[model samples]
Target: MWPEVKIVHGKPTHSQSQGSVERAHRDIEEMLGAWMDENKTKDWPAGIKFIQFKKNRALHSGIGRSPYEAMFGCPARVGQASAGIPHDLMNHLATEEDIENLLKEMEGESNDLEDPNSHGEREDEENTVPETVDAVRTESNEDVVCGQCYTVLPLGEEVNNDGKCFNCERQGNIVNERKRSRESLEKQATKMLKLSKKKFSEVQVGTTVRVPIPDVDRARGSPRNVLAVVGSVEDGLYKLCMCS
Candidate 1:
């Protein structure tokens, strides 16, 4: 009877239930497409996570609130983020600070980094997770974003150290690029298509899936919900279209 949608970060990631909330479901599907294609993460859950985090903190125009803040009354809190993460890495798990530290330590112990027998190339440890940055509503006003801070960065711009701010060249852990990459994908609907894009993927004639929609599926719905066939692809899409 009642409708409910789940929020990842600060945006409506899925319509978990049904209601009259129909406006932009397809858009979310499109987002997932772009993310999976870019990250090449064949794993369904892994890919959705990639896009979910980005949208939570994106700036919103409607009431000027990201879905994250609206859902939980706050912005998205990124636990930890690594730096220079390669796209297709099977064994690449370098941490955020591994950039110079790893390289320095590796070169210090070995003469040739490109050596065949070399054990260390950059960092000695595996990829370390990024530290959590507080993403919340303003201290006094729980609406506007004062700005996010980096955990690793030293205080002030005078330090001339890592985690510098993009706006004022300050210090920070998560860069603007990473943040933007996530936000851009949120506009589309990637999760929807992958999870329930087609027909007959549900339990019965129109079973609801307990999952989140991706970033690129560009249909219409506030949270995004529709009816479809049980496993018959043709029945699902065609019937689902009528429900929408």
Candidate 2:
């Protein structure tokens, strides 16, 4: 069993106590915002993995190294999975340019009657056509769908019990719309925080400021701000003292 860690609570008035955590949250929010824009989907669970990967790899300004490097005491091997492929095997792999070059070579060789061996190679490739066709047909036959309706049919054993396709069990649901709503909510929250930050006026010691009051906890028509003078400013935050 691991040793129990003590949690130190910071004063609600001073957010500077949890500066690192707040900063990290801001960074993650920015990343999530970008991902939402790029993917245009509410699949945040999928995108979180990519965010974590980037965070671990990215260099920390304070640490002078990435989180992965700091923890492992070594630089992370990026794309090592793909890089592990043998150089000889990689060279043998045909890319688009290689395929294009191959077509050009075949065309040139086709005209050159001098190369009788090239024709034999082309004939050998053509011989595999029947096998490919048979494989496609076999796969298509195995993928049996509901004959009455075009929906995917159940497996052999399941089909006997149900006697109908899965979609036949009617249910109305808007899964895609729900996901879009969630995505919109997350984006709106991020945008609101950004806009609020921008609208915030700079405060210094002796400067009076107005802050919003929660409507749920108090009366809806209650005054938004109680006149409060800034006592001190540290780390770009105002320490406000209420004026009598």
lDDT of 2 by residue, 136-211 (tens): 6687676555544656653441332444454442211133333444566677668877897899856657887776
State, as a TM-score between 0 and 1, how close model 1 is to the true structure: 0.25
Worst 10 residues of 1 by lDDT: 128-137
How many backbone clashes does every candidate have?
A: 67, 0
lDDT of 1 by residue, 183-218 (tens): 555644465466554643445555444444455553
Top candidate on lDDT is 2
**Model 2, residue pairs in steric clash:** none
The lDDT values for all models are 0.47, 0.64
Off by over 4 Å in 1: 1-23, 71-74, 78-95, 98-244
Tally clashes: model 2.
0
